[model samples]
Target: MRNFDQWLSEMRPSINEYNFYVNFEKVYANVDSMKVELNILNSLVGSKDIEQDFREILKRYPETLRCIPTLLAVRQHEIYAQDEEGAFLYDFSRMNYSVEQYIAFMKKTGLLSLIGEHIINNLVDYCLGIETGLDSNARKNRGGHQMERLVEVYLKKAGLEYYKEMYLTQIEQTWGVDLSAISAEGTSTKRWDFVVKTDQRIYLIETNFYSSGGSKLNETSRSYKMIAEEAKSIPDTEFVWITDGGGWKSARRNLHETFDVLEHLYNIADLERGIFNSIFV
Candidate 1:
C-alpha cells in the first residue's frame, strides 16, 4: 500500500501548459459564422439617427433580430422580463410583436442607448468582447479537458487501447456485462470518462483535476466512492479513479474515505512514475 497523505501532497496544482486561456480560434469561427447578420447590425454603430436606422435595417433584414439576444451575452432566443409597467417575453427568433414592442425592449435593455450613444465603435469588435466573456464560462470545462488530454498521452505511451466518453449501454453491449446499478434508470444513461482494456480485465476510468478549493470536491469524492462500491458487483471490471488538485486538501475527510475504499485511486504523481504500465500489465 502507498501513503495517501504523501500522494495528496505530491499532486499538481494545475495542468495548464498553454498561456491562452480562452480558445480564440473557436471565438473567431463563431463570429465569422454570423458575419452577415452582425454586419447588418453594424449599421447602428455610429448612427446619428438610430431609431429609423434600426427600423430600416430590420425592414431589409429581419433575420438580424435573432442575433439580438447574443449581443447582450445571452444564448437563448427568448428572454423574459418584467417591470412596473408589465411583463413581457421577448422572442428574438422572429417578430413576436409589433416593431414598437421590440423597440421598447431595446430601450428597456439599453441596447438602443448602447448603439445610439456610439458606445461601441464597431459591432464585430464589441461582440468579440462579449464572446470572450462568454468563453470565460468554458474555463472549467477546459480545465477538465486538460487533465483528460494529459492522461490520454500517457495511456498511449503505455500502449493501452481505450475508449473515450463511453456510456453504460455501449460498454455493456460490447462486453456482455451489466451496469444498471449506476444508471439512474434502466433506460437512462451514465458515462465514464475513459475505458481501457487489458488481456485480463476491463478498466472503467474516471479522471479530474481541480486547481482550487471548492464545495464540489467533497461531493465528487463521495460520488466516485459510491461508484466504486457498486462497480465491484460487475464481473471483469475494475474502477480506476485518477484525481488531483490542491482543492482535495480542503475536502480531505471525504477524499480519505474514498482513498480507503479504492485501491486504484491515483494522482498525477503516480502517472509521472509510470504507474499505468504496472496497472495495465
Candidate 2:
C-alpha cells in the first residue's frame, strides 16, 4: 500500500498548460464575428453632436446595437436597468424599443460618453481586449481538460488501449464485462473519464486537477471513496483515480479516507514512476 503522506507530498499546485489561461482562438472568433458592427460604431468616436450622430448610425445600421452589450463586458443580449423613473429590459438583439429609449440607455450606461469622448480609439481593439478578459472565466474548465490530456500522454506512453468519457453501460456492452456491481444493477449512470481495456481487467478511470480548495474537494473525495468501495465487488474490473493538486492538501482528511481503500489511487508523481506499466498489465 502507498503511504498517504508520501502521495500527498507529490500533489501539484497546478497543471495548467500555456493555452489554459486564455483561449485566444475563441476570443479572435468572437471579435471576428462582431468586427463589422464594431467598425461601424467607430464613427461615433469624437462626434460633434454625438446623440444626433448616434441616432443617424442606428437608422443606417440597426444591427450595431447587438454589439453594445459586449462593450460593458456583458455576454447576454438582454440587459435590465432601472432608475427613479421605471425599469426596462433593453434588448440588444433587435430594436424592440424606441430610438429615444436606447439613447437614454446609452447615456445612463455612460456608453455614449465612452464612445463620443474618444475614451477608446477603436471599438474593434477594445472588443478584442474585452473578449480576452471574458475568456479567462473558462480556465476552470480548461484545467480539467489539461489534466485529462496529461493522463492521456502517459496512457499512450504505456501503450494502453483506452476510451474516454465512456459510460458504464457502454463499457459492459463493448468489453463483455459485468459492471453491475458498481452500477447498482443498471440503475446507476456512472461515466468513467477513461476506460482502459487490458487482457486481464477493465480499468475505470477518473482524472481531475484542482488548484484551489473548497467544499467541492471534500465532496469529490467522499464520492470517490464510495466508488472505490463499490468497485471492489465487480469482477474483471479495476477502479483507478488519477488526481493531483495542492487543493487536496486542505482536504487531505477526506482524501486519506478514500486513499486508504483505493488501491490504484495515483498522482502525477506515480505516473512519472511508470505506475501504468506495472499495474495496467
Candidate 3:
C-alpha cells in the first residue's frame, strides 16, 4: 500500500502545455471569418460628423452591422439593453432596428465616441485583440483535454488496448461483462473516460487535473470513492482514477477518504514510475 502523504506530495501544480493558454489557431480563424466585415466597419474610424457618416454607411452597407457585437467582445448576434426611456433588443445578425436606433445604441453604449475619437486605428487589429481575450475563457476546457492527452501518452507507451469515452452500456456489450453492478440495472448512465481491456480484467478509468481549489474536488473524490466500492461487485472489473494537481491539497481529507479505500487510485508520479507495467498485465 502507498502512503497517503507520499501520494499527496506528488500532486503537480499544473499540466498545461504552451498551447493550453490560448488556442491561437481558433483565435486566428475567428478573426479571419470577420475580416471583410471588420474592414468595412473601419470606415467609421475618425469621422468628424461620425453619426451622419455612420447612418449613410449603414444605409449603403447593412451587412457590416453583423460585426458590431465582436467590437464589444460579445459572441451573441442579438444583444439587449435598457435605459430610463425604454428597453431595446439589438440584432447584429440583420437590421432589426432602424438606422436611427442603431446610432442611438452606438451613442448610448459609447461606441460612437470610441470610433469617432480614433481610439483604435484599425478595426481588424482591434477585433483580433478581442478574439484573443474571448479565447482565454476556453482555457478551462483545454486544461481538461490536456490532462487526458497526457494520460494517453502513457497509455500508448504501455502498449495497452484502450478506448476513449466508453459508455457503461457499450462496455457491457463490447466485452460481454455485466455492469449492472455499477449501472444500477440500466437506470444510470455513466461514461468512463478511458476503458482498458486486458486479458484478465477490464479497467474503467477517469482522469482529471485541477490547478486551483474548489468544492468540485471534494465532490469528485467522494463520487469516485463510491465508484471504487461499486466496482468490487463486478467480477474481473476494476475502477481506476488518475488525478493530480495542487488543487487536491485543499480537499486532501476527502481525497484521503477515497484514497483509503481506492486501491487503483494513482497520479502522474505513479505513471512516471511505470504503474501501468505492474497492473495492466
Put down candidate 3 lDDT per residue, 92-209, tens digits, no spaces.
9889879999999999988989999999999999988999999999988787798789999999999999999999999999999999878878888899899999999999999999
Q: Order candidates by TM-score, high to low.
A: 3, 2, 1
Model 2 per-residue lDDT tens digits across residues 2-46:
789988999989877988889999999999998999999998899
TM-score between model 3 and native: 0.94
Model 2 TM: 0.93
- Give the per-residue lDDT of model 1 (tens digit) for 132-206: 889878887777688899889889999998999998899989888777766655675778899998777889999
- Measured with C-alpha atoms, the lDDT of residue 233 in candidate 2 is 85
Worst 10 residues of 3 by lDDT: 139-148
Best by TM-score: 3
Error of 3 at 60 (Å): 2.1
Q: All candidates' lDDT scores?
A: 0.85, 0.91, 0.91
Can you rank all candidates by lDDT, best first? 2, 3, 1
Which pairs, if any, clash in model 3?
Answer: none
